[model samples]
Target chain A: MRRMSWFNATSLTLGFVFLYLPMLILVIFSFNASKLVTIWAGFSTKWYGELMRNEAFLDAAWVTAKVAVASSTLATVLGTMAALVLVRAGRFPGRTLFSGMIYAPLVMPEVITGLSLLLLFIGIGLDRGVLTIVLAHTTFSMCYVSVVVSSRLVTFDDSLEEAALDLGCSRLEAFLLVTLPIIAPAVISGWLLAFTLSLDDLVIASFTAGPSATTLPIKVFSAVRLGVSPEINALSTIMITIVAVGVITASLVSKRAAVKRRNEEQAAGRA
Target chain B: MRKFALIALPYTWLVLLFFVPFLIVLKISLSDLALARPPYAPQLDLSAGWQGIKDFFGGLDFENFIWLTTDDLYWKAYLSSLKIAVISTLLTLMVGYPMAYGMAKAPEEWRPAMMMLVILPFSTSFLIRVYSWMGILSTEGYLNQFLLGLGLISEPLMILNTPVAVYIGIVYTYLPFMILPIYAALDKLDGSLLEAAEDLGCSRFTAFWLVTFPLSRSGMIAGCFLVFIPALGEFVIPSLLGGSETLMIGKVLYEEFFNNRDWPVASAVAVVLLLILIIPIVLFQRNQQKEREAGQ
Candidate 1:
């Protein structure tokens, strides 16, 4: 059963290569000496230097960062509240509608979501800018956050909160002391998920952002639309590397936590 | 009281932001296009009272929807989008199945690392992932150079800015979605069932067909939906990777709103897109409902 058959091994290798080879190529070519992106003559660090000095890219990155941080924080709070309602509320009016609204945005097309949101902002005469981007990002990403946090909530031990209640605590106090600390990991992951989502968004940001405010993705899209340049390749490489490191580090940390918990539980049982 | 506050806050936010905006799109889809700043006509002016309400309803028409049917550009875009989505979803399934099967079939201790490897690319920005293909698929790109160097072809292939490139981009980016669900389904499958099938005089291939493949059906369906739904309304792939010859409803919708400044017609296009999506969305919901009920 543990035998590694050639059939499975070949497919896995080829499949991963197919999935990753393009990005690998893009990363390798980022250091190319040529102005034209595809043709590589020799190694150079000029594009990275150029990327640093490009004010437009820097400004866009700043806006994107601000939007991601603010929106993800707001989304985390709203989404945690939404998750509490979903997991704990019973037989409330509009329960079905509430759940429906939470799940619908996860599958809604970006174009549709963006367009609908834009019209809403315009209909009420809200100027499109950073504020609008934050609003739009918060609305959609909050759904993702709720989905993340709620999955953890469904498996949560209610007896701990009950124990807190039995100790003469109020409902809110019980929740803060018992429920939140237990679910903090999921909540933090939810925040990170929302953060990445906000950072990755281009279509929604484009619709909600005014001419005065541009995001990094919008800048990359417009630049790539003109044709691929070494600077963009350098930029893509940086983004990919950062995400790669972050994801790897996260998985390792979670893995170690799981292993430590299992070992401690075993030791406690043996003792 | 606190529970009510908890429920009401998100509820009100969704109602105002999500639900109301959808109704607005539906209303604008019915209204006429204007040269005004907001662009659509038949604005529902509450200030004018019952008279304004009556005039608004009277002025609203299905003219833009009728316009959608009359123009063949929108029709071609719809059909092409459907075609591309169907093909790409199939391609993604073909590429992702073996990988997911491999992950599920791997030895126990290696699974976590393998799973992380699969998900790592997905954490990167989607636009960057799609843009990665441009450097490889361009005529003078690495792919052509490699093929020509290998003597695989006499001349470089023109893959970029074509439907083929769109298929690649979609399949590449959405492969993780396809793999994850199917892997879940396969990982849950009992290995003993396959062993018993083989013990009952079935060959290895026969046992897999009889016992394993059928069990993975739910995951396959879910994975297909995950890829197909987003691919249908994808704008970035077509606009960036596809040539001018390529047409998709999402790209058209974007052009209508931003390039042409025709809000009513864009809303009409969106309405039709949603109508098309409703079928799959309903099916997906029903499938999930069935799975949930079955799980219980």
Candidate 2:
């Protein structure tokens, strides 16, 4: 076995510390009794309690949840379709352009995407509100979902679908029963990812949001810009906790599924 | 029929929602600004049908683009954005390379957890993460306080409200993008190749230099572009962290659109930014195509 090099050890420790230090600091300071973010006077849950009492924060969070749910669901459906077309559909007309369009949004600057979509909304005389935000988020987030689903699709065994067809199931039926079930995990993960993205996005939402459709990120951004109070830190800590719990739960579920699959395969081999 | 339905649904949605918007932006970019409800001249009248379309095109001009060229602020913003993006990309790579390498070298069982750890911060609210940096890097923040306590500094270092803070904020935010791709590249590397080099009397460092670094070039490039492209258009980090000195094009575009209400000018800026981004966009597409072909 290769020994752990000093360089590797130092890099791992330092890298993790660098990545987590700001977040840890934010979390610890969220409970500080002082209004000032820098000084740690004493620990208290007042800020968290105050955050709970903030009506604007509560409203933004509700808007964020609505947008995340709507957009992620929309993105998953559309993205799954796009992924299927890319992976399973034979070369169709405008295949190259279609692929480009699918992937272009992945790296397109948020400002540009936001700006362009805003312009589109204005040009089409559509109202800029939660609907526009959902549309924008869905459009961009679906591209990411398509990428994830497409990678999984590329590795999928087409023979299974072919066999299902041979066994008298129609293509749609087979896909619904077999392919969809198998790719459900990827689709779910994609939805989760899209949800997180929609939730985290401030720039896009800022451009597309109407007077009454403020998202949590936009709200947080405005408050943070004004000043970094413990209230914002308290909000951040809560947001971090939610994300951490979600990710950890997702990871554990996937891990357990993998182990179960392995055990089933082992039993089948023994039989 | 099923296939047609599947294809038509998303394809139509993207075309209407994603592709056509760029055309609208292009159209707006060519129009002159006006003090109207929508704030641009030559508004397309769909009610007039074909004649309205012709009239719209007829009224469009390159006035906004011309105005963009005359302004030094736009040029400076573009230049500063490029400079900062390049520097930040390099910094992210330098920091991320080691972290990625270390993660890839970690035991197999720990790899997933390590990756999850790297990605956990990324999943958290991006605005919050940037806000967290302010608490650490401000003059009276944690960094200054710690350094003072350790007697490492005489005065509170002017870290915040500078480009240094921007760099730090960027590196912190984009670090995962840099790390994930490089770790993937390193993880896929065969151990036997390194062992073969070791048996041939090469040291670990030399072997890594010759074998690992060269192999990881694509991942590095991928990571760099991921960081660089977004960093170029980054508005939040510079505004909140870099103070007034940071003149990224994204901020400029934001100001022109919202502050000045120059929708035409903002559209022009977005058009030019897209044009500037075309090179990397093409490069990235080519890389993806090559990867797909390689997979095949």
Candidate 3:
């Protein structure tokens, strides 16, 4: 057991407080009856009720949800394929460049990605709307998904697929029956990550989204840019809650999967 | 055929969406802005065949690049962004390193949860996270209220819409980037190394400064790169948290495109930003390669 000194304890506590305090304040202030950040008015859920009544916020949210679902699904597919290419297709031609492209967007500025893609849409004469937004989201978020899935792929045993092949399983069949089942957790988590990215993205979505098709972040941005409002706080509180739950669930799912995989391996070895 | 299909699918997707778009940015950056619907000159009219390609190349110039250089705003924004990204990265390191060290020193069973605690912010909307601070940093915000209530200051300090707010936002948002890398390094350090140093007649602090810190250099470097590179071109944090004086290339590029509708100039700005980024990105890649080699 590593010793937790006074310094370490204080650092951890203070660090976490710094991290969580603002969000906690936002969430708590969301229920305030008055539209003040500091003043504690009586607790009421009126802001949330107002949020429900707001048609524009609701419509933007609906559009965001639709974009998230479509883009994340598409990203998962392309990302998994890219991961397979990076991991399994060893020493292929242009492998370095391929991997470079895969990783580049991870650190690329949101502005550059957004600007370039918008230019592409205009250059190719593609209309800026939900479809353009989906394409842009898929392009960037796929890099993230590939990173997640490829990390899992690295630790995966190559012999397991070989065992399936030795039993006369076709390559495709072996992949579907053996490889896919084991890596499903990573892929699922990848999808979740992509989904969250799509939902949270502001800059990329803003550039790609048409004036008529504003996403929640763009709407929230315009609203918050003026000043803090209880309605914006309520929206943020809800988003923070959703994302926290989603991230936790994804992490837990992956952990559980690892344990389950170990148990199945142990059982098979004993047999 | 199957192998070909697997490679081609994603390769084509990236080439089209990623690489091709980048080339278009490069091309447009050279061309002059036009009042046309698509808003750039010398787009190839293929019906004109060989003559069109010649015209396209002929119309391209270094003027946009020159314009960016001549404008004090563009270069100043670039420099200010560099200054901001560098300072914030250092701040994040100072704030993050201790937390990471604490996590590494924690009891084994508690480490995972602590790590998750660090990552939980990522799941939240970034705009919301930055916006959360506005309420706290504003004159009537909680921080000021608390300070005034405690009799720390008679007047509320103007923190919102200032460079200080932008710094706080960057450090808050990018803390995880710095922490995770440093934590990974610290976690992998063999406790025996510190003990060995201590047995050689060194204090715990000296032992850490000499042995553990040197060992964790790679992680520290990686963490810095991760923080600095993204922070350099960050749009959302600066735009939301920054005052008009908080000049960043990302926000400038954004305004150039959306507000001014100067697509050529916008593309030129992006091209330059990418050029500036190539240095750190290349170093990051080399660092990653070295780490991988060391692992092997």
Stretch of 10 with least lDDT, candidate 3 chain B: B236-245
Error of 2 at A171 (Å): 3.3
User: What's the lDDT of the predicted structure labeled candidate 3?
Assistant: 0.92
lDDT of 3 by residue, A1-271 (tens): 5568999999999999999999999999999988765688899999999999999999999999999999999999999999999988988888888998898899889999998898889877888999999999999999999999999999999999999999999999999999998898889889988998999899999889997799999999999888889999888888888777777777787788779889998999999
**Per-residue alpha-carbon lDDT of candidate 1 for residues A1-107, written as tens digits (9 for 90 to 100):** 57978999999999888878888888888999989777778999999999999999999999999999999999999999999899989889899999999999998
Interface RMSD of 2: 1.1
Candidate 2: where is the Cα deviation over 4 Å?
Answer: B46-52, B288-296
Off by over 4 Å in 3: A1-3, A91-93
If ranked by DockQ, best first, what sequence of candidates would result? 1, 3, 2
Candidate achieving the largest DockQ: 1
Rank the models by TM-score, top first.
Answer: 1, 3, 2
TM-score on B-chain, cand. 2: 0.94
Candidate 2 backbone collisions, by pair: none
**What CAPRI-style quality would you assign to candidate 1?**
high
**Recovered fraction of real interface contacts per model:** 0.79, 0.83, 0.86
